[model samples]
Target: FYIHYIASTLKILHEEGYIYRDLKALRASCAQPVYFSPFVKASNVLLVEGRPVLIDFGMCKNISKTGRTYSVCGTYHAMAPEVRALSGLDHDTRAATTSGYGYPVDFWGLGILLVELLTGKPPFGYRNGDIGDLFELSRGSPSTIHWAAGFEPSRDLRDLVESLLQPDPSKRLADWNATLNHPYFAGITDDMLPPEWDSDLGTEL
Candidate 1:
């Protein structure tokens, strides 16, 4: 249920030409799978009426017109490899070059969140809770899941996670439309989605 909600949220954001750089457990608010949240880490998520909702927008980025951004921001463990790669360069270098990222970064973060939801830990080992270690791990290689005893996930689900976590953003799932069409969401259709899920918020940002 949370997967569907998150996918829908991503769909909405994509239609609006924005990228939600932050995706993590604390960034979601849910009551039996009604999810919403905004920007950054755990502290930004809040509960409303027993449902998790994203409450912070401080780090949200509007990329509708340009379809990309180069800001090296977002939590370490949840960042896409390209986003983490930017950390080694100075801001001036980033601004002077065409190197940056786009919506795929959010999908990478969502992949991390999905792993955490299933296994109670990020796909990459937490690296003793060190931010630098986490970034290094994220930038190194794609993660392989090792489920706890008797907690194995379905093959389709695992495939979905792996696809989203692809190190190459270009090769990652191509936005929410492609995501919702995956086998993991086999039976879900546009008719079942909420009205807001289809509304185009436009490229005003």
Candidate 2:
């Protein structure tokens, strides 16, 4: 149900030209995300009639034609590498990136959310809580990402997670239309699919 709920939420967010702020749900061991309650902690999520609803849009950003925006916010582990790297930099430096972080950060967060929900741990491991180390791991090749033991997820799930976790937002899955068709979401019920909406990102970057 979380898979369907989150997928649908992503669709809604995409249609609205908004992206989810980095979630801080998952923590060490039971950072409380393993149960699929949302480890960035469930403070941002709520259950209504057994349906998981995402809440807290305080950090949401409006999408531009280019999908790039400035200012840094998001939590460690869940933060996209680009966002993490750019955070704390002066405005001039962030502007120099040619493209500041955008909708892709949400996809990255989705990947983190999924991994935590299914694997009981955020990708790259979370034993140390060192933002620097997490940032370094985020910048590394996605192939180096360590999937947890005892959790042999399906190939499609792994593929989708890796794709969403792409360090480069350009390569990550942010398109509302494209994400709905991922094999991982193949089993999502029709009611769980969010209504379609126009996007400046198009099908992909």
Candidate 3:
């Protein structure tokens, strides 16, 4: 459902530009997602009759022409490493810097979402409420994200989260097909998503 919403938004953008010639070809091509929704956290998503609906397009951007945006927007804890670097900069400095980000930023946010769901908090921050310390974590190098002590998820889950969270955009799991086939979601299909979670399993906690 999430993919469907994003894909539809991008399709609408293509239509508006009058550049959409062959819809079939456009859908078949292995295109990176063009709609960049920097803010993809839980609060921005709503559950509507068992469907996951996204809201808050105020920071949403379509990277159709230039293929990247240098604008720094989104919550720091859920923001991508690349975007996070320029978050607090002035508009002139933001444009001066060539470190623009594309669709891969969403994947980083997805990884942060997974970590937040599993552990109840984002993994990096400047001890307590300091945003500066959080910036330091993703500043100069590839950020190192680790599971908090004593919370050990299975190996497959760990691997998926790590791949999605890779600080390097090139190395991150940004492919839609690859992510759907990952071991962590092996048995799940589009028709078998969040709605199925309502089934009652025996409780142990």
Q: Please give the range of 10 consecutive residues that has the lowest summed lDDT in model 3.
A: 22-31
Residue 63, model 2: lDDT of 78
* C-alpha lDDT values of all predictions: 0.65, 0.62, 0.52
Name model 2 segments beyond 4 Å from true.
24-46, 88-98, 130-133, 137-140, 190-205
Per-residue lDDT over 1-205 for candidate 2, one digit per residue giving the tens place of the 0 to 100 score: 5655666776777777777776534222221122343334443443333455565667877775756787777765677777766664322222123357777777778788777666656776653553444655444557656677766879998888888887767777877667768888776764653333333433432
Top TM-score hit: 2
Question: Over the full model, what C-alpha lDDT does candidate 2 score relative to the true structure?
Answer: 0.62
Residues 96-133, model 3: lDDT tens digits: 23377777776666666556545545556423464553
- In what order do the candidates fall by TM-score, top score first? 2, 1, 3
- Model 3 stretches astray by more than 4 angstroms: 1-46, 88-98, 126-133, 139-143, 146-150, 193-205
What does candidate 3 score on TM?
Answer: 0.63
What would the TM-scores of all predictions be? 0.72, 0.73, 0.63
Deviating ranges (above 4 Å) for candidate 1:
31-52, 89-98, 127-140, 188-205
lDDT of 3 at 176: 58
